[model samples]
Target: MNIKLLAVGKTDNESLQKLIDEYIKRLGFYINFNLEILPDIKNAKNLSEAQQKEKEGELILKKIQSADVLILLDEKGKQYTSEEFSGYLQKKMNSGAKQLVFVIGGPYGFSDEVYKKSSGKISLSKMTFSHQMVRLFFVEQLYRGFTILRNEPYHHR
Candidate 1:
């Protein structure tokens, strides 16, 4: 199955973007992976937190198709070990999902609409992370998950 990561705004840090790109490249060996960055909302300074989430949510929902499995990267979501995550991915692939879309919401987090649209949620950790950093972390974990599934040395190293 094809896997897609949808995140709001651009990753401005050169270091972070480089690392995120590296993991994306490695992930290509395992699955059709795409990282799509949605443009940031204009005039966001004038909007309330809820308004910003609503606007971001609209952009997020627009990218999703009815058949896509939507998973939100959220703090309050289910947490899993690396091996368990690999199993989770295996189940999705076996289930014959066309695409698994995971989202990293904007600074203020997701809107009610976005939450409602999600099929599930996953938490990398209980600790908070910058949205940009989360991009790197999530991709790296994805790469690691594949390596673990294949019994590659990358997981132990």
Candidate 2:
């Protein structure tokens, strides 16, 4: 199955982008992966939080294919251990899914409409993280998860 990571805005920090790219490349060794960036909504000083989310939601929806399994990276979603997350990845492939779409919402979070369209949600941690930082963390963890699944030296029990 193909894995697509959808996030709003761009990663401006070069160091963080490097780390994200490294993990993304490592992840490619195990599975098909794509990192998609939705341009940040312009002139956000006027738009309310709800309206911003709504606009971002529209942009997010536009990238999705009909058969994609949408998974939101929500703060309130269930958390899993590295090993468990590997299983989650394995199950998706076993189920013959075409694409697994993982989304990181905008600063204010996702719209109700986006929530309605998702199949599930996952929280990386209980603590909050910047959207930019989360990209690094999520990509690294995804690489770590795949390594764990393949018995690679990157992860330890």
Q: Give all candidates' CA lDDT scores.
A: 0.97, 0.93
Candidate 2's C-alpha runs over 4 A off are none
Compute each candidate's TM-score over C-alphas.
Answer: 0.98, 0.97
Highest-scoring model, lDDT: 1
Model 1 Cα RMSD, 1 decimal: 0.6
Tell me model 2's lDDT, rounded to 2 decimals: 0.93
Weakest 10 consecutive residues of candidate 2 by summed lDDT? 148-157
Per-candidate count of clashing residue pairs (backbone under 3 Å): 0, 0
Candidate 2 lDDT, 1-157, residue by residue in tens: 8899999999999999998999988888998999999999999879999999999999999998889999999998889998999999889889988999999999998999889999999999999999999999999889988998899989884
Model 2: per-residue Cα lDDT at residue 9: 92
lDDT of candidate 1 over 17-102, digit per residue (tens): 99999999999999999999999999999999999999999999999999999999999999999999999999999998999999
The true-versus-predicted C-alpha distance at residue 102 of model 2, in Å, is 0.3
Cα lDDT of candidate 1 equals: 0.97
